[model samples]
Target: MIDTATAPGSGGAPPAAPTRAGRRPATTSGPLRREYIWLALLLVGTGAAYLWNLTASGWANSFYAAAVQSGAKSWKAFFFGSSDWANAITVDKTPASLWPMELSARLFGFGSWTMLLPQVLLGVASVALLWAVVRRHFGANAGLLAGLALAVTPVAALMFRYNNPDALLVFLMIAAVWTMLRALDDGRWRWLVLCGLLVGFGFLAKQLQAGLVLPALALTYLFAGPPKLGKRIAQLFAAGAAMVAGAGWWVLVAQLWPASDRPYFGGSTNNSIIELTLGYNGLDRLGLGSGSGKPGGGGAPGGDPGGGVTAGVDLAAGGDMPQMHGGFHPFGGQAGITRLFNETVGGQIAWLIPAALILLVAAIILRGRAPRTDGKRAALLLLGGWGLVTGLVFSFMGGIFHEYYTVALAPALAGTIGAAGAVVWAERERRWVRAVLVLSVALTALTAFVLLSRTPDFVPWLRWLIVGVAVLAAAGLVLRGGRRLTIATLLAAVFVGLAAPTAYAVETLRQPHTGGIVKAGPATDSGFPGFPGGNRDAQSDPESGAAAPGGDAPGGATDAGGDADRERAGGGGPMGDEKPGDEVLALLEQDGSAYTWVAATISSNNAASYQLAADYPVMAIGGFGGGDPAPTLAQFQRDVTEGKIHYFIAGENHGPGGSSTSEGSKITAWVKDHYTATEVDGVTLYDLTATPKAG
Candidate 1:
């Protein structure tokens, strides 16, 4: 939303009337009366999209779901994002995103509602916030359209309903944008400070990913904000300082805390939170660091045990096999410019990207030679820059990015479409603007058609129908039925733009995207192309007796971080078969006392399943990737001797960074060599209590 409301002595243009019938009502109260109705509709629609069948996925991404449960059980776990309430180690990513989920669990007790409800509410709030922000500067109609577009975006619906950090990240990023726009509206430094604070919280939500919009916000203020340069710079500095304080304090506290009192930083080789930030969460994600494809780089809590190196269990070891099919390319391709639009990712987030780009260029050109202070021009630049910067970063960054990461692009696309469409619609009476509308609708429909083609069998009829509607709508835009025809065509165009994503969203909701990077399309049994892991086939992990029914397994099926594996501990419903079955549970319960850890395993999902099944701490010894030095051989031996650990479950040896020589692997080897193995419920178990005590 763009406005020319000026502060005292600030040089700005007069506010343009809102586009067409979208004009502000005669009185402020009058506008609110009608606006509230649309806002309510937007909120309700978004809520339904996000909350419908919300628990079908059960504890979606049981990896993080376990963390949410842990955080609910203990304050220390809540702060550290510990997968088990025992606080042995932390999840790789920051815990800010999980705080709310944990709070919900604390209030409601652990269940699907605690796991998925926060995301649903956040999705609704995001829609409302988008409407308010767009309306403040654009108009009621434009704001409503923006909210609708965002609400229907396939990725938006998929992510807002899912329990990943991306949902909160998206919400915070949008909040930051709204705050910055408000700051620009009145040239208020306080608003700017608030924007910075929101962004800093965004950092806490997703680390460096949050800074993707800083460039756009900074540039907008520097080039287009009110009045003098010195004051502006000073105000920006204040904002920056506030941002540093908001984001840095947590890192500082994490670093300065006594190591003995805190869990080891999960992804950091050196056990430093700052190191984890700079390495795995920062440079590695950009493909600038060597750890790009390593465990924890994508900021997933329980990383792929082998770092997406290979899937399927190694029968000999009873865990993920470290067969070096390739150099840890989980999604299976080199990072490049075309990554987001490829087969694996295109259907998820790229469907509307081309339309957004076309609309942006058209908006800019339609405002040809407008004065620098023109509100429309300012709006175009602000939105264009925001979309371009975030989109480019995602496009070019060489990291272990998942398809679901496209959720970040949702707001940019929605904002661009809403604001640019308003500008174009406001000028639609112009022949050129009408032509632009026709072209925009055609491109949008065409792009959506191509994206839909990727999964031909999914609502196959809609493909031709959308193209036909788009063509007729364009013809109507050009025909002679006057404003009524034009309005119908515009509505048709909006319909065509939203239809594909709406269907995809419905499909997304209908299917249980329980694990791995969720790509929008009809749910398929095929695993990700070039995925080096197990085929998306429902099979039992021979060691765990954990059967994945129809490829939607419980604990191990997901990739971790974004789209995760569907494998749960139990076989059905929210909790799934998280328990270790009756036999294993009985054996473990026989000597449950005097042991700190219920079971030890290399897979985070494995441990998560056990933790959820038993509601007791199961140590994911080596962390998500089975690579982090959460427990070395010496530490394990010492713990066993001290009776801190009881059972050691054998599983995958491969860690994210390398081969089976990791701390967790060594401990497993030592345990295997010394202790007698017991096969309980398909899991190879080592009873530490059965070993003789060495004097």
Candidate 2:
């Protein structure tokens, strides 16, 4: 269907006419000059968008924020990603993602701005790297378009601005792809090794999620690499070794360290990093066990944790509301091929998927007859494979899935769309190529319409406008015209594809997103119910019982003060969104320096709020989800008897699957049984050293 005679080579552009000296002309002339200008604009625009309101979330996801604070104060905590400087328990994730933020906080004094600035920088760098990777094979225009797509992707906007490990994980994945591509170019062992090294570091960033790209990387190189079969196999082996060395050293050190001397491995049932990696962060994530037993617990997005208000429930017609697991659903919907297009997920990163896949198939078929070393086909295979593999896993994986995890797919989608668009455009004179391009634009427009319709009240007219423009652009493309008219039609097509996602991205920037689970765009009818159309302030809804923005209460608690009894009765929830009230901070800070733990609480998020507000080491009893057996009853009682732990803050002792038998629940029961409860600014606390009273 494609005319190979007119198709551009791997360089995308025709080779420049040879000069007298037989060298390429200076880059300042023509297309090369334009490329530089556009590249600069892309980077500048991406940086501004990402940094627009960097500190508005104010320590977004306080669970990790608390870890960053602790890491700043204690090198041991920094290395271990401990929730407290006293080395009580590490955060459930590996520490690589926190290192940059910790170092920033250590240098500038921990605060919202310092803690989140590094994440913004990582976001900007990822965009720039993506541009470079795409530009190498495609022309400047395609590279710029790909970069723009990623920058405006809603989830990319969310995670890049938020302090989540996903940001670093994404950056490493893109860099690895770039390095692997370089290896394929020349069969260079060093390039392959470098790619392996990046992936290894990626493992440290988020464990096995980093390995999803490996199959694509290895398969592409094995099939398309310039080296002979034996040599390519040997080179891949070296790269694998590099990957092990890069990621293995940390695993080795962590496993070898004395468990007592280090913070307990927070996610593991046993104090073993190996178990944490292989179990909690690994197998459990694949639906083999309770999905990670993560902090928020899994349910539909914005669904009531108690199942009183199901995500899709209509409170106006209320009868018996369905009860489901509390917290956001790991995947947006049931695990299936269409999961990415569901109401909860489509708006985040699925905007361009339909277009990307269409164009990917077109590009691969167009280049099917090219030699094995063809760079264009290799790139298509690499990016398309990455997107397909990662997308399927996110769609079907039964473990702790979140809508935001879709950020991993953004780079691949963006790159594939750009590369494929270029390949097909080069042969646009072929009627079939034009048909494929028009089909892609039409499908993308339809996708936007469906996604926008889910949140009908917000930007109601934009969806129709996108469809209108796409229809016109498709017509214009079908009917050959003058060069200016063709360019105009192409611009309209691009607008149709990008408009809704950009609007969602901007909305994501406008909102103040906090807590362990967050969704992009304005609240939709399917996921978040309490907030009316376009009202994202869940804290303002008294019925929601969510922590107010910047308030130091746990995520699922009532207001401080008059509701103390109800709050104590209800127990604490996931990540707290607000700062600790001043009175509570003062209470925790009083003579806090003398104790190893200024206070202790059931969940990491609750303890994170108090520790961050008081600037002290507050122990998270059983780590995130309050389920891990970190400090046993004996260990906690010993600490309390020795005056190491000063107070026990009343909070949720049980998590999604936890019970009274959990170590955290036992600690809470023991403390409540022994000490007099004191109400500080509506927070219940038991003084560990005030002397036990007969209950």
Candidate 3:
């Protein structure tokens, strides 16, 4: 689709060509036309790979579940309801992660379409940006290849459809890149300002993660270009100021929420000056300070929830938990940042190393010392460095390990392939080499595809094909001098290109239900969705009916502001759940006057709505007529005694048996004696709000 519409020219940098922005159609024959054809095929392939995963993918369910849990309805529920509506009042520590969806929620309907649709579109935008960056900085063919490579990478494919912050992160990064490149192309300072604004928007989208790609681009520009030091520095400063202006407003507004509403978890502090600038971002990755994680944990989120010890001793309780700045924290030992980088790069780069090496060979052999065109080296340095740094830094961390972490490296890999492809195509002497390279590239990409398929154990023929591609890639790497080097690089491209198909064949042929009960997919049997917006923190809390971080079975006002006096009243004494406001679910389950649930948490209205779908089935007024959790306490108690609530479950990990704390009273004892357990959407069932069953 993009191919027919896009025309080249109207840009700057080395190897300058005539302005083609509005120029007549410049016809090319034989080789050039063939290259264009190849590019079009690759882009189509990329689009297919990314868009295909949208259906079978399981990544977006948790957010949907959380939205439901939060009592959010219509469109406003899904998008604005991060994790869940229960999280609305509670501070979430998933990096500075919700801004893009939050904005989307505000702009579009926050419900299903708002949360799910934007990601798909943004992902496509990222692909488009990648193409532009590669095409303008490098060449049209290179741009197409690079964009395709990114679009087809397994991680990129999954993430683009997954509805996570990472997809938006990619888009913001690409947007920033496109803006900056445009600025450079037209020598427009306004574009630089636009670049800065987008970069800052990137930060707002996901905080620290967005900065990785954008800053790297700037630094690369500063170091790799013509070295116009003064102008570059001034331009960068201006860009930075623009970015601050675009993104800084959010920080100010976030501050207005209670410091507790935006707790400085993972070391994000609300201290003076700097904290406001970076208080809620990926503070974990940046090393510890301002009440976040320390390097000992590899800059991962500190598993320990010590409420900042600076407050000295917990004068009130005097309990012996790790204390930081007078706050109480929890027990934790997580995968450190160092380990994160290794796994991300280690898992994916091995597939890429051979390709990168082969591409490099092509670069050196055909294009190295020869009369080079404009800005090629500078572009490679900038594009390659940013992709590598972003991927590597994230890989070294041990704490989190998701397959999609490799998206950051997409641009560079694409650049490398595009760079190599150009060299092989530019020279006529490398004809055979180019043929072999095409074959190998096709095989490697094919292999990757086979591996990622839902089913597996591919046909024997694929194994042979993989071996063939590998051999070609190796041969390409071997050639570095003149004709031989060009041949080797061409062989390499052919080798990598076919990897995905082989992988696909293998995955598709695997045994049915090979992995057992299907882990990461739909959970009609268990309402505990996969995403992390649970009322309780799944990391710390046990799944066995006892509540912790997100455990709140009753609907009561939860003060996220570390107000230890938090009451779990209705009949149970206050030993509330793990984190503050952690008992959102526990409170919601208790039967109330007129059966109204003033759901005060950040989860969606779905919890109430879905409950209506299941148990109440039909109701004149839904059981969850939203009210303040704190105010509804007494009525909730009366409703429970009147047999309003038969049971309740709350927390991040809760399904049948959720986590809980010791209650000072025996409200539970009465429940145990009178109520019978049942099931609703795989969640723990109780007769709450129902008349006690006859004995």
TM-score top scorer: 2
* Candidate 2 lDDT, 101-160, residue by residue in tens: 999998998888788889888988998888877776665677778889999999999999
* Predicted candidate 3 versus true structure: per-residue lDDT over 9-111, tens digit per residue: 1112222342423122354456456645666676565555444423322213332223333323323223222322323221122323454445565576444
Q: How many residue pairs collide in each prediction?
A: 31, 11, 163
Model 2 earns a TM-score of 0.89
Cα lDDT of all candidates, in order?
A: 0.67, 0.75, 0.41
Better of 2 and 3 by lDDT: 2
Off by over 4 Å in 3: 1-49, 64-87, 90-115, 224-227, 257-281, 286-349, 357-374, 398-401, 420-461, 470-492, 501-695
Which order, best to worst by lDDT?
A: 2, 1, 3
- Tell me the TM-score of each prediction against the true structure: 0.87, 0.89, 0.59
Reference-based TM-score, model 1: 0.87
Top lDDT: which candidate number? 2
128 Cα displacement, candidate 3 (Å): 2.6
TM-score of the candidate numbered 3?
0.59
Error of 1 at 273 (Å): 1.4
